[model samples]
Target: MNSNAIKARKKVLVILTQSPYGNALSREAIDYCLAAAAFEQDLTLLFTGDAVLQLINDQNPSTINQKDLTKTLSALPIYGINQFYVDSNALEQYGIDNDFCVPTIKVDVKEISELLVNADTILNF
Candidate 1:
């Protein structure tokens, strides 16, 4: 690799589809996102299915001896990650409305499909 070469930043889309507390998948996904952002990757996070629950406010993971995922999610913008998306159908299925821990764009099935097609890389968890 030449020192003067300009590296192109790949658009990375991380799709989280698991419950935040059940397993380590959600944590690992978040960690991966932060690491990718640290390396100057263009990051986008899409929460669908059970993963949409991660956006709920007033999460108390301490009861289960776990760190609060919402707290960590709030710091995403500081890492230059501003594209947070939630599936509208999932939100409806879960009955979540305006109670998100972080700001997010609600996307429909079509939008989600478009996101998947446009991303340079996809990480599903």
Candidate 2:
């Protein structure tokens, strides 16, 4: 009921576990994050499972005539959504080197758990 509480922006965590290019889920999730960021919400984007692929650089989705999601992801900072976290296990599982990914914090499952617990709002895709 206090003014401060009423004006506070919720901490929103977006967990993306799907791969980009093959489907539209990643694109939609990115759109959601951007929309939430436009509202000035505290946003954090976690790339896990196959979603880690979205952070990889130099993707040429244009070969398949699909828009490059990684390119879109690189624009997140402009939207004020720069908190990027990647699951270390997923990176290893997919044989993806972190050097190929965008600016991100490689995290273990335990740290991911901590993030989920601290988030005020969580959206998974």
Candidate 3:
């Protein structure tokens, strides 16, 4: 099937490596997905590399002039974007876990890259 047709009947995966407050792209990407979910789109979120920082615990962010991404990540379920994922080695390298992040699957870079290629539409933020 073509890309739009695939997406129409399948899930959307968003891979985020950008931080919440350093720039607006990350936040915008998430907000756009929320909007997509609002439209009944099936959505999944994956965190890897530096993006794992988005799930770090208890970030007050005021000191760094950033919004608390943890809050946004925690709200995924309410928005129906609950199929979350994290690279296993990235979690080890970044020191994170399920409790500190959205419900996630353990995936490595190889599988992750494959997921991107296979996805009807892969969005990186």
Candidate 4:
């Protein structure tokens, strides 16, 4: 039997470090995450650096002709990707508080290190 068939599912960590609307990385990350979730894989999403801006609530991307990412991001739990974490330092640097963004746990570098070690696979964008 295949090793994949033997293991139930593997933990996947997705780290987003890109800005939200200027390019396609953010959208691609979401697509990858939803696809992984559809496979019943354990998933964790981490927003670091400028990517955390994607979570900012009450965004009106129509002005820029971009789709509203917050709406899609908030729906992650509905798709079974509930583990969301943000870098506390990034949050502070960006002048964002938890309330300003989609609900997520704020973690420091040490905690991020632990999450990386525990993840079976990591995808960074």
Candidate 5:
């Protein structure tokens, strides 16, 4: 690599599709992203399909007797992980409004495609 070349920061786009319960994968993803963010990497998260429901507000997994990951997701901003994104139509399809997601996360279906296209790395879970 040329010393003068602009080394782009590692950019990760994580897609959380599965629901946030029953398994540890959801929380794992959140931790992975936050850890990467701690390294000053460019990290972003997206919610699509049925996963949009995971962003619903006031989530209390205790109802199912499991740990709650919603609060963890909400605390991403404090970890330098603020570039969260969610599909607008997916939210509508799942009947979830914007207030349920990370604060000021840009929501849109088509725009999400553009973001994915521009990402250096993408992991769909």
Candidate 6:
């Protein structure tokens, strides 16, 4: 590789569909997002299905001997990862309204489809 070569940044969409704390998938997904952002990748995160639970404020993972994910999520903006989305349908199903630990855009099915179609890469967790 040439030293002067510039790597093209890719539009990466990371979809999280699992519940937090039941296992390590949610944490691993977050780690992947942080790593990709560190490399200057254009990253977007979508929380759908049970993943919507990850966004709720005042999570208490310490009681279960796990690290608090909300704290990690709140630090995403510092890594230039400002594009966070939650499926509107999921929010409705889960009855979540304006209590997210971090700022997130609520995307309808059409917008979610557009996001998937437009991304250069998609990662699901």
Best-performing candidate as measured by lDDT: 1
- What's the distance in Å from true for residue 20, model 1? 0.8
Where model 1 places Cα greater than 4 Å from the true spot, the runs are 1-7
Write the residue-wise lDDT of candidate 1 on 38-91 in tens digits. 887888999999999999999999999999999888888888888889999999
Return the TM-score for each candidate structure. 0.93, 0.91, 0.79, 0.91, 0.85, 0.92
For each candidate, the alpha-carbon lDDT, in order, equals: 0.91, 0.86, 0.75, 0.86, 0.77, 0.90
Error of 3 at 114 (Å): 4.0
Candidate 3 structure quality by residue, lDDT tens digits, 1-117:
677765555667788887667777777877877788788787777777777777767779889777777777677678777776777887888666656656667798898887787
Query: What global local distance difference test value does model 5 have?
Result: 0.77
Lowest summed-lDDT stretch of 10 residues in model 1? 1-10
Residue by residue across 1-125, what tens digits does model 6's lDDT show?
A: 87457766678899999888997999899988889888888898999999999999988988989999989888888999887899999999978778888889999999999999999999999
Whose TM-score is greatest here?
1
For model 2, how does the per-residue alpha-carbon lDDT over 69-122 read when each residue is reduced to its tens digit? 877787788887767989999989989865654588889999999999989999
Candidate 6 regions with alpha-carbon error over 4 angstroms: 1-7
Clashing pairs in 5: none
Model 5: residue 87 alpha-carbon error in angstroms: 0.5
CA lDDT for candidate 3: 0.75
**Clashes (candidate 2):** 0
Which stretches in model 4 have alpha-carbon errors above 4 Å?
1-6
Model 5 C-alpha lDDT per residue in residues 1-125, reported as the tens digit of each score: 69558877767789887778855777788878778777878877887776676777878788888777878788788877777687778777766676675764656867888778878999877
lDDT of 1: 0.91
